[model samples]
Target: MTQEDKINWLKENEPILWANTFKIAKGELSDKQTMFCCCGKLATGLHEDNCRKFLQQVKNETAKRLQEYIK
Candidate 1:
């Protein structure tokens, strides 16, 4: 697949995550919204790269949140 096809596939398959790229790149996410995105993606089985990256981006301050979910 070409780069363009890969881009289109992401947009089509991960619309929510694709739309979030702009906000994520800008580092505009609050702790609450970051938590929401992580949980929502896992609970819904979205599991896109954005979700993993976003979780890692916020991981330091979000250990408590992860603890709650894991326990």
Candidate 2:
């Protein structure tokens, strides 16, 4: 999927993931923080995913669309 597509997917399918990731990116949340996620596990973590897929998509962004998804 394209970067925008991946981001949109996260926004739609993984809201808590999206919000916390942005928080980490903006330094508003600790990278070490852990919270319950809708993924039905202990955490989606402070990051999006471990595959680096999302990171590869957003890391180079100079104007990263920090839009928090709400569904």
Candidate 3:
């Protein structure tokens, strides 16, 4: 799926995770802070399946922004 599709999926299915992930990606939240799952599981912010997917979307978005800067 496209980055936008991924984000929409997260927003619709996992609103809290989406919000936290976006804030953290945008540097609005400290990178050192831990992200917790709805079930209270500790998310590594990388390897956890949903977080990983979200992060890939974040990475893609960042790359796109950087490309804009280079243009």
Candidate 4:
């Protein structure tokens, strides 16, 4: 997806993630699922998934910004 689309998608999905993250932080959930909630890797596979998604977003947005600059 385009950077803008991806960014908007993130923004929209952030609330759900944020709430879940809070629960994780409060010990209501496992760290494995919410480890990446604060930008750190979780012990579970979920952290890996979040890491990949975060990296993809960063990469896409960086490329998009670069392209805009080149223009």
Candidate 5:
């Protein structure tokens, strides 16, 4: 509830959190894209914010592709 409590909880649960986060994100990626993402994340380690960024990027691209397909 408190900031300290939140920080402690995150530290204590990081492995589980990391696993679940990757699991869900992996499910969302296409096979090729998933490999690319995994390589990037592994290379970047602590600074990888690609999960969120990639989702936004994919959504935008998908929308653009759909519009092009429709036209």
Candidate 6:
């Protein structure tokens, strides 16, 4: 899927992840910052895999948007 598609999917299927990923992508949050879980707990080792995947997808989408804007 395209970056936009992946982002939309994340937004629909995972709102919390989408919010944090978008914030990081937009430079509102630092890469070193930790994301919190929906259950009000720290999402360190518990959600690392999914969080990493979502962050990567958000970064990819931001890069694509930047490239398109440059073009």
Best candidate, lDDT: 6
- Range of the 10 consecutive residues with the lowest summed lDDT in candidate 5: 62-71
Model 4 scores a C-alpha lDDT of: 0.45
lDDT of 2 by residue, 1-71 (tens): 56567566777787776666765563432243356332334445444554254444343231254433422
Better of 2 and 6 by TM-score: 2
Q: Candidate 4 lDDT, tens digit per residue, 1-71? A: 66666445544655464344434433432333454443555535455445655445444544443343331
Task: Say which prediction, candidate 2 or candidate 3, comes out ahead on lDDT.
Answer: 3
What are the C-alpha RMSDs, in order, of all predicted structures? Answer: 14.9, 10.7, 10.8, 11.6, 13.3, 9.9
What TM-score would each prediction reach against the true structure? 0.32, 0.38, 0.38, 0.28, 0.32, 0.36
Candidate 2's error at 62, in angstroms?
13
Give one clash count per candidate, in the order shown.
0, 0, 0, 0, 0, 0
lDDT of 5 by residue, 1-71 (tens): 54344434443556465345444544455444533553455423232355666654444443333332221
Q: How far is candidate 1 from the true structure (C-alpha RMSD, Å)?
A: 14.9
Kindly report which residue pairs in candidate 1 clash with one another: none
The candidate, 3 or 4, that scores higher on TM-score is 3
What digit string (tens of lDDT, one per residue) describes model 3 on residues 1-71? 56565555556766665566556564522243367642346755444445554455565554444332231
C-alpha root-mean-square deviation, candidate 2: 10.7
Each prediction's whole-model lDDT (CA): 0.44, 0.48, 0.51, 0.45, 0.44, 0.53
Q: How displaced is residue 10 in candidate 2, in Å?
A: 0.3
Better lDDT candidate (1, 6)? 6
lDDT of 1 by residue, 18-49 (tens): 55563454254442454356445542224433
Candidate 3 has a TM-score of 0.38
